[model samples]
Each structure stands twice: as C-alpha cells, then as structure tokens.
Target: MSVATESVPVFAIAPAEDGQIAFPPAMEARFRPGLAAVHDEMLAREEVIALLCFGSAPRGEAKPKSDLDVLALTNGTEYWKRSRMINGVEVQLQVGPLQHWREDIEKGNPAMIDAFATGELLFDRTGEATALKRDAEERFRAGPAEPGPKFFQRQRYAITNIVLDLEDMAEDSLEARVLAGFMVLEALRFWCAAQRFWPNRKPWVMLRQLQGRDSSLGAKIESFYTSYSSVHAIAFTDAVLEGVGGRLYELSTDPEPVPS
Candidate 1:
C-alpha cells in the first residue's frame, strides 16, 4: 500500500497521511480489501508497471451500485480484462500495454483520455503513468475537434436513410418504433459532435450534458422519451437535421478513382 516517495509522480492524486492512495470513502469502505488483493496480485507480476483507478469511484460520483474500474499498465503485447464480484460490487480490471494506452490518448480516444485525465494513480513504478495522465489532461482541456464536412456528410447519409425507412412504415408499427430508436441515437451523436462535446455512454450523464449545451433540444428529447410518441420522435429528428442543413432526400458522392 506504500509507494516509493521518489517514484510517485507530482501530478498524482494525493496520498493519505499513511502514504496510501486516498480513495473516496464509499469506495474505500466497500472495495478496500478487494482492491488490495488485486493490487498485490498485479504487483507480484514483473510486467505490470502501474495501476490506476478510474470511473465513478475515483471521481467521487459513485452510487450504491457503482463498480470499481482499474486500469493496469503493463509491458505485454495483448489487451485483456478481468471481472470479479466483491461484496456485491463489480471489480473490473483492464490490462493493456503502456505504449498502446499512450497511443490511444494521443489519438483522442474519448474514454481513454477521460480515464487517464481524472484517474487516481494507485501505483507508479516509472512515472510514465503520471506523464500519460498529464498528456490526457492537456488534450481534455483543449476539447474535441470541430466537426468537419466529412462528419456532417456521414451523419446526414445515415439519418436520411433512416428517415426514408420510417416514412414507409406505419407510425405506431413495431418497425417504426425500432427505426425511431436508431434516429434518436444518431441525433444525439450528431448534436454532441457538433457541439464539440465528448459523447458519454451513460444515459443521465449524456442528458445532463446535452441540456447544459442546448436546453430546447434537450427538453424536446426528454419529452419524446416521456411520451413515447412517433410524432415527437420525428419532430426531434427534424430539429437535429435542421441544424446540419436539413434532411437529405438525395445524396451525391464523387468517388476518387483508384490509382493503378
């Protein structure tokens, strides 16, 4: 539980008075023993270079059912995962090559960037984890790239196809319902990307972020979910499409000729 003082990174989460990593109280109380067990096991392996705790637990947003998410940086070539249930909480462990993780952060992988930026360093042997976390934070502060022409084209293509299919089906039919689901997902993705926001997978988190950015659109989306009507769904889709130059009835593409 004690890290070498010299090896600890300056940017790491502050250690406790006893020199152990400081975890949120709820997380510590529920997963301390289990975390210790896994930490010991990973530390015993020579290839394991560092361990970081991420997600809700380390972020102080844990609920009663939140799981502990740990990322193990290693010198291995392959990626793997291990999951265990400890005291009714899931202990999810992800092991991967350190270089691979660094590449992911450099490439703007949203989840990976978020994890390293906010993760608590539980163990660091070479200070590389701290460096990666620093890099992630910089990227996060810079925010996501603005959506380009290709991004809008792809979104419009998919959405236009979906709307076309919906137009041919009865509004209350099962097929229309299924297509409505796809429309909603596409709309959310388009809206988030246009607003330069990282799309969160969690429902409530996504909704809150969406509302923060555009209250009118967010309220419209919420109403669709609340009423479960096809009319509301179509209206929401139209609103999102309007932001990106309206619905496309016909899309023209000019293919690049293949080089011989």
Candidate 2:
C-alpha cells in the first residue's frame, strides 16, 4: 500500500561509547553563546528576581532541534504578553511575581513545577528564585499533590469504559479499531492524571517510561504491525492493559474481559 506511517520525532539521544549519556558537547557549543546573551540581558533587569537555563539544554542531552526554556521569576505584578525567541532558540521568559509562580506550582502546574524542580540556576541575584526552586523540588518530590479520591474514581470509570470499547473494536473494522486506539490514548491521559505521572510529550516516550516498570513493554507494544492491523490493535490494547496492571495505582478490574 502507498499509505504512509508517521515515525515519532527522533532525538539524537545517543549514549557515548562509555554508555554515559549527558549533554552532548556539540549542542552546548552551538547553543551556549545565545543562552549566555539572554541571561545577561534578563539579569540586568531590577524586576527580574530569577533566571534559569532549563529544559533540554540544561539537561545537557539537547539536540540541535531542542529549544531552550528559560524561566524568569520576577517581582512584576502583571504577566508578560509572551515568550520571546533568541538566535533561533525559543526562550520562554515567564515574568511574574515569585509568589504567583509558587501558587501555580502548589496547584500542580505540571510544566512549571517540572521546570522549576529540575532547572539549572542561571542567575539568582536575589537568591529568591533559588529558594523557590528548592520549594518546587520539595513539592514535586511530594508527588502529584494528592489529586483526591474523586479523581481516581473518575479514572477507574474511564479506564473500564475505554478498555471495553477497545475490546469491541478489536472485532470490528480497521477504521473502528483505529478510532478505538485514539480513544485508548484519551483514556491514558486520565490514567496518567490519576498516577500523577508526567504525560509523555511524545507517545513513544511512554513506552520507555513503561519499560522501567515492565521491561517487556517495548516488545509488547512493538508486536503491533506496520499497517496497524486488528491483530496489532488487539495486541496493543493488551499491552496497554498489561501496563495498567503493572504501573497504575489502585486499578479497578476492567469490566471488559481482561485481554488474554
């Protein structure tokens, strides 16, 4: 068939010969000058309390395709209109009062909390942002902010329903099963929410995350065929169910017959 299958975005995430994976030096060489410039410009501001070199670049595994995420903790009451770009790299300069940013973190603003928790300190002239970063790490380590019983109850209900729908679609037409896979992904969002796990920005990353819990998840998910046949559809659903069994906390029995 002439049909195309889209591949997930490839990160040039290669480990060195020593099997150690860290920030690739070439990317640092390419990206550092621009980041240094941005740091200088932002630090010169009196209202800017904290500036960080965060996201992929700070983590050091960045590819040329990676965009830099910079956070600015500020004394400004009003929010900035938008993030600006520098040297083909996107700089997310979120300018707001430290208290306001902390409020968002406490409420479990996933992106902000993750960034603040792991971000490298760029310039902390007042030391306030450094304190906030510590607070963010403590909060993040405490995990998912106790999403409550109602949240888990809703997710269990959603998981049961989505499982059943996939079971039914597994016997039907290809179009129907494809739709069911989309529905399965929808159910996974709830599952991730209930787990307080970060939803993978890329779908394939989930398999790696799952592999940490169940090593064979990679092989299990890969059993799904190239054309995405019903065999693959059903197999993928079963693998997902396997992941649910192993990874999810306090799972409800799928009202549908458990995928064999």
Candidate 3:
C-alpha cells in the first residue's frame, strides 16, 4: 500500500446522494441499449456470470457523448476474443481465464464486485453474481485506505496523466483544447485529493481551484469556459500557465513523511 514519493496523483469525485456517482442521465439512457446488447452476447457465450456498467454512465456524470464502461465477470476467457469489432468500435473487454477470474475475485480486484454491488445489474444468472457483489461492497466499505504509500500509489497514474494533459493544451487543435481543459481539471482533482481536499466535478470548482493559483486564468475560464464552450477556457488556460512561469508542482521530493 506504500506509494513512491513520485507516484501518480489520485482524485476524488464529488459524493452524490447515497455516496453514488454516475454519468449524465441522457448519456445513461443512450447506453442502456448497448448494455443490453453486450449482455445478450455474454449469455450466448454462457461465460458471463454477471454484467454491470461502470464509469460515468453508472455514476450519473456522463456527457451526451460518452463511451460505455462495462465490468463483466465470466467463468473463463475461452469464450472471449481479444479484439472483437463490435459495430466497428474496439471495446476493450478484460477477460480472465476461468481460474484467473476466480483469482481476480480473491485478490480484491473486485472491479466486477463493485460494479455489481453498487451498480444496476443489467443481467445476472444463477443469482451468485448479486451475492458476490454484496459481499464485495461490504469489504470495500469496511476497509480504510491504508494511507501514506497506499494513497500515493493510487495517485501516480493520475499525476502522470495530468502532466501529459498539460502538454496537450499547447496544441492548436480544437479537440486538443477541449480535452486539455478536462485533463487540467482532472489533474487539479488529483492534486486536491492527494491533500484530502475535495473539489466539485463541475466547472465552478475548476474556476475556484484555478483562481487560488491564478486569478487571471480563473476570470478568463469563468467568463469564456462553458458547458458549450471549451475554446475560451483553453485560451485562458494557456495564459494562466504562462503567467505562473510554469505548472504548479503540488508535491515535494523531500522524502520526509507528510505531517499529520
């Protein structure tokens, strides 16, 4: 559970009602049919024990155009294919060889466990999946984050991603600008979570967080950044980073333990 001093950062999403987080409603409705389709395929293979949606769709935070995030626990990967062109999109489905699938459950990668326990089950066979999900949820809630190394280890990917995202902001492409802004917010959330400071997963939070670091950038993003407009935010972000002389390094490499 110990993370390296230079591990990636972790992010915490705003807690929704009942500790729930999810994709936007419109996006969820659009994805439900697809979930049905995937479930049907699983049943056909007889390999799927349970299927649940994860990520923004289930979390109620998805935009109009978000991809589906599915967690499936199957008996084996024998029935699974590496790259199936499902309607031309490459859906990255992680499968475990039957025995490995069980091992994943034992090892606590209960990604499938959490999805089933907290998620709306699109399909379930034999009812064992539901029981497994409930058991997994109990374990997740009962356990405390081991803190220190554990917390830092979880943050590494997020921090690394944030760095790359900043690099993307320097691009001239519209898509790059839009994605860059999201990455910026994501990076901010990671930093905040590492310090146990939670930020709302919406724009207002972004503006507020940026304002603490750079007022001008905050003003620009607030005025120009919109649910409908990312270009304005991108331009302001460029200015903000420049003004700060560079990006903010939220972590120190002193190797000293963080003071409680």
On lDDT, the candidate that comes out on top is 1
Question: lDDT tens string, model 2, 1-260?
Answer: 01111322222122222322233243466666566666666666778766666677776767777777766778778777345567776655556677787788767687777788877766555556666677778767876755676555655555556555666663558766676567546544544555567645655555455546644544544554344455555455555545444223354444667679
**Worst lDDT window (10 residues) for model 3?**
8-17
- TM-score per prediction, in order, is 0.83, 0.69, 0.45
Poorest stretch of ten by lDDT in candidate 1: 10-19
**How high is the lDDT of residue 78 in model 1?**
85
Q: How many backbone clashes does candidate 2 have?
A: 1
Which of the two, 1 or 3, has more lDDT?
A: 1
lDDT for position 50 in model 2? 63
Error of 1 at 94 (Å): 1.9
Report every candidate's CA lDDT. Answer: 0.78, 0.59, 0.50
Error of 1 at 121 (Å): 1.3
